[model samples]
Target: MDPIEAAIEEIKSLPHDQSFTFSEIARKHGVVRSTLIRRYKAITEPRTVKAVKQHALTPDQEIELVAWINRQNEKRLPPLRRLVQNWASEIAGKPIGESWVGGFLDRHQDELIAKWTKGMDRDRHQADSWHKYKRYFDFWHAKMEQYSIEPRHMYNMDEKGLMLGITNRSQRVFTRRMWEKGELRSVLRDGSREWGDYPCHYL
Candidate 1:
């Protein structure tokens, strides 16, 4: 609890004939006397609690908005700022200001972040599923066993390609949990043909 609130509670708990004044309780708890008095008399609530009521969306509506953002992120299609602003406007029954999105993002920074998405080829994205990777690894392990291959003889190859064109990077909102886990970077784009490849090998 806040120091002012704690002081107010202490004051309220005093006996009717006790010799404690608001100033004494405030000094004891290291809070301002006038603030303690206001709080004790129920003249105001904590600033953090009051700020919620002043938000464009109600608490319940903001929660629903967060849920929608999470669902979009799970589909690998996070919403852009304009889309979020429009959704918030619809929820609040009024058009939000240009700066509302920034404030909203700041308020929910723990749960969300705005990030530039890396482009991924549609075909490559579709082919990179769990089952396909598992099958490839399983077949490789079987072949290694059949050939009696030693670990020292194994070679790994990695291919890096550069597409020679300007690619647009759009900012999208994603859950901080996914970002921390390194899962919020890629978004599908059209296949590219103008490319240069460099191959590296390691054993």
Candidate 2:
């Protein structure tokens, strides 16, 4: 807004009591507080505040901007966005430019993401097949009836730990952008590992 016109408007609104707000000027006359301050150089600052660099974001302001971006993308109420902008400006420790508030997401587009939730891989556990052994049960029942044999008279025989010497090998996978600056490691076979490699070997 033109400064000369804003000065005239504020002068007209001035009553016997010279108490008003800068926000009132901004809304009523479409004039920013800085323009009026420039016009009326002798205006007393209402609050005690140290002068701060304009448009430069403080560490706290940066975090508020990030929060604003997330809230805007969340499809929330209009008041939420305005609250975020207000919070961001206050957190900046100075009057922040409107462009800085609006352009935060655009300027940091790569950093802000519209993710609904944390990405996760869902795993479905499937059970392996089990045998009913219906035919085997029938055969055993028939033999018992034919020979009048009891289950107590039967002998059980099976090999235990037949695959004890056999080993299963597994491979490790890495997909990071950068790894340690060293040799590329490959998964070795299980047989390559030995119990005797331990320093404390016992007889």
Candidate 3:
């Protein structure tokens, strides 16, 4: 079953008392709690869910999320509730909820996500003589060979690329707590990863 669909059905099967909190569902999936939030609602509606699966992270909040997640390291990742709270606080330029921190963490499975994360630096430029003058690179390469010097001068000759993926859509909590099958996908996106549709075959 689809992750989101299965999540919803699971939530519906649960008792209403427990259904009101997404943390419970997140734990079941072993994902962090933020996995459940979407837009102004913690639970993503089908409409928003469709957009996300399509890889459209253009929503204002989502865009902001990508920027923040990309710049930080996975090690800086705090507890789910704290992560969400910090996300809001950082984006809104003010403190929000402390409880949200924990709620968010419960949504994602830490183990599976151990290698998944946000942010990257891709704008660093290298003054490559290769592009300016084909002969420039050859000259450097040849020069280094003559002196037996390490080709550190032209070691790196290309610019880096940055790709940010959607971690959470971010939703508002209507009731006291959050409840939803917290399913977060640790997606990686960059120019190379960009495509009009999902690849036909999964790697």
Candidate 4:
């Protein structure tokens, strides 16, 4: 079951007495009280669908955007942020700005990441051809298997240029240390072990 649905069930299972507030239900179900309240209202006011707040893009529209982005990426042709903003404006039939882009990015952060790429970077100057990358990957995988090389033994360092024109968001500090043989090495991002960092580290 969905976590939200489970939370709804938990709220329903609670005693009818007003003694237990939404906070109590939230704590019991490990969900935010605000989320619980929203779900409760949703359940009790099913007819009030129009009152629900929604993002500018409908769910289907967002899915279409996701597909378009993925297709662009598969062709090694990433769309610029400004291009996305223009697309949004075209869809809405009005000029949208950076604020809309920022909110859209925030809502879809789990499915996408914001990366800073140098405009003059030669690494991505040419669009990657499928056959070329496939050949490279096949050779790389064969070499890895022959040497029993594991991903943990590999590390990549890429320098990201600081955008002088834009304001910095937050500072990131990276510390490195060599580990002894047979010792487990741990890596973290944002000063804590986050599962999201695993994919970035391996890549």
TM-score of each: 0.59, 0.22, 0.20, 0.36
| Error in Å for residue 122 of model 1 | 15
Q: Write the per-residue lDDT of candidate 3 for residues 1-203, one digit (tens) a residue.
A: 64655655777787767636677766776655675545225455566567555432224754465345433423222123346466667765766667533433333233112222344324212322245456766776676777677644443311212212323323322111111223222222222232223533211
> Once superposed on the true structure, which residue ranges of model 4 sit more than 4 Å away at CA?
1-54, 119-203
Across 1-203, the per-residue lDDT of candidate 4 in tens digits comes to: 65556778876786788466777667766777886687678644333344333356666666677666656544334455676777776766778777777777766665544444323222332323566668967987877787787968754432222223333233211111111221112221112222223543222
User: How well is each residue in 122-171 modelled by candidate 1, as lDDT tens digits?
Assistant: 55556556787789779878777887777778754312222324345556
| Residue 72 in model 4: lDDT | 54
lDDT of model 4, residue 16: 87
For candidate 2, write residues 152-189 as lDDT tens digits: 87643221111232333222211111113211111122
Clashes of 1: 0
lDDT score, residue 39, model 3?
22
Per-residue error for 35 in candidate 1, Å, reads: 2.1
List the candidate 3 regions with Cα displacement exceeding 4 Å: 1-63, 74-84, 108-203
By TM-score, the candidates rank as 1, 4, 2, 3
Lowest lDDT block of 10, candidate 2: 120-129
> Which wins on TM-score, candidate 2 or candidate 4?
4
- After best superposition, candidate 1 residue 192: deviation in angstroms? 8.5
Ranking by lDDT: 1, 4, 2, 3
Candidate 3: worst 10 consecutive residues by lDDT?
Answer: 172-181
